[model samples]
Target chain A: MVTYVAIGLLAILASIKAFHYYYQIKRAPSQKQLSKLVLSTLRRGQSDRE
Target chain B: MIKKIAVTLKPYNRVPFVYQKLKICRNCRHFTVLGERDCMSCGKTGGLQPVEKRAAGIVRRDQWLTGLILLLLIVIGLLFSASALQTVLLIAAGAAAAALLWTLSKRFTPALRRIQLQKMFQQYSYELASGLAIDHQAAIRVFQEGDKPRTYEMLREIGSLVHNDQLKLEQIMLLQTFQLRKDMDLMLEPLLMDSFSPDLVAYIGEMAKIRRDLIKENTFRYMLQHEMYILNMPNGETVLAAVAGAAVRKSRYMTMYPYLLIRYARLLPKDRFLRLYKFAKSARSGPLYDEVMRIYEEKFKWDPDFQNA
Candidate 1:
């Protein structure tokens, strides 16, 4: 019974880690996308001035 | 006889200015301008120079005293360790003595010296920030005469008072003196975040946006959010309304707006993007207004529902 309980806990921990990695992957691109948007805005500004 | 008289008169004329300059030094509570080389007042040789008061001598003396006290405590601790009770008592006494010495140094010497040093630096920084040429000798005196902490505090205070673009531009030239960009950013952060003063915020935002630092993205995001919030609110003052209306009309957030609009449009079945589009269309035309309209038309080609209206 104790062994079974330990196995369950390990499974839960593994799932949590997997979920965390997925969340990080999802959030990382949003920050990059925001930066890209700002860069593009700056480029557009330069082009307009020219 | 005339040449001799002229020389004597010249010497007499210069004596008043010299005396006037040294009057404060002579009357200083710490002054000891005895005939001997050493100053009897502060116990240092040649310490009473014909200049303004400085704290460098006090700093050196305090450092020496702290070091000596620490050495004495270490020796005392080593001698008393054979008896555990005596060792404990000796340790406690040493700690108390150190604390007392620290308090005395803080209250009597370094604290007062730091206040004087900070005042001197503040005056120098204010003059520099105001676009006036700083006296290099006075600046060097401040740097050489004050402790590091006192100098840093004075710089921070002076930097915080800088509100004009010219002053900010001048102050930013001194960024090299600070260890981290965040220290300078902290001094600028409040001015940038001021909600009621859009022009100040815009100026700070422009400066931050130009810098290839983390502050650029952070400040832009803050400005964008602030503009959006001001626009969404119904009852805003003229300045807030003008800034928001200008920002929206100009489409300052054009690149990011489509992504946000698409998401918001998806959440609202009534199509909120159309409302924003109409609002932008009706808003007065400016440089930003034209840009905003171009982005909306290019990104979202929603059929005009007003054709039947």
Candidate 2:
């Protein structure tokens, strides 16, 4: 009975972790996207300054 | 045009006298001040301009809230480790918390960056307005230096920005630096000399006392300067009470209690001091309050009749 309970808990924890990772991947921009946005913003600001 | 020229020339005639009083950049390593259209030392051709002070980035309310939630989840997870079910629940909570934080950061990073840049510009303007002659480069250098003595120097320059009037931003910056480095002597020196809103002056005095830098006599004198101003205001009294409580808890500046209490006694309602005295008497005696009460008795000599009556 204890072994079955432990397995269930492990499965639940793993599922939760997987779900969270998937959600983050969907919600957050990749590092490349973030860097590109930052660089473009910097260029725009510099042009405006000039 | 003749009147304008005469008016302009008038300043030159007075320049010798004023120049004697003015700080020259030649001796100052941080000096960026120069004549019209050229830096005298560097020969960089531009009008002699004062340096701008920039503000640090502003942390928005949402960012703080998200950060707090993430911290709470992590703490809860650590605390629930004894129970397997609870631990598992907490681990899930932690994963959810991280995901939320990541989402918020991605959405808000640009806005946060803009707020930060604006703050830097504002700080730069404040420094220039204060006569610090700080440019962006100098400001960056000052921030990068980041040693106690260097921080103190930066604070001193910033404090100069607060003269006869209370400049809130300048005062906040100075206080922020002083909070990091408890240099009571440096912090109190300007407060002692300058005229400020009674609440701010009192707040600074309380801080000075917390650091055990204010002797009873000096604290009494400071209180006397704005006694009526402080006594009439509720906010001033509240700030004083908070500082006193904090000092008692910290116990590092125990010697400053007498002066602080004296100021409190004079400004606060009789009932307020009475309650405070009761709290102090019942609370575990520390070096701070012991010295405070000792000084209060020695200086004022209330006798046995006024013992928490």
Output the number of the lDDT-best candidate: 2
When summed lDDT is taken over every stretch of 10 residues in candidate 2 chain B, the lowest stretch is B1-10
Candidate 2 per-residue lDDT, tens place, B67-141, comes to 574565456455645667766665665566566556656665654444443333333332222233343234436
DockQ for model 1 equals 0.01
How well does each candidate superpose onto the true structure, as a TM-score?
A: 0.22, 0.28
The TM-score obtained by chain A of candidate 2 when compared with the true chain A: 0.56
Q: Once superposed on the true structure, which residue ranges of model 2 sit more than 4 Å away at CA? A: A1-50, B1-155, B158-169, B176-186, B205-209, B215-219, B238-309
DockQ of each: 0.01, 0.03
Docking class of 1: incorrect
Q: Please write out the lDDT profile of model 1 over residues A1-50, one tens digit for every residue.
A: 33333333334433443454345344333323432432333334334434
Each prediction's whole-model lDDT (CA): 0.38, 0.43
Which candidate has the highest TM-score of all? Answer: 2
What is the Cα-based lDDT of residue B197 in candidate 2?
A: 65
True contacts kept of each: 0.00, 0.00
- Model 1 scores a C-alpha lDDT of 0.38
Q: Each model's RMSD to truth, in Å? A: 25.1, 21.8
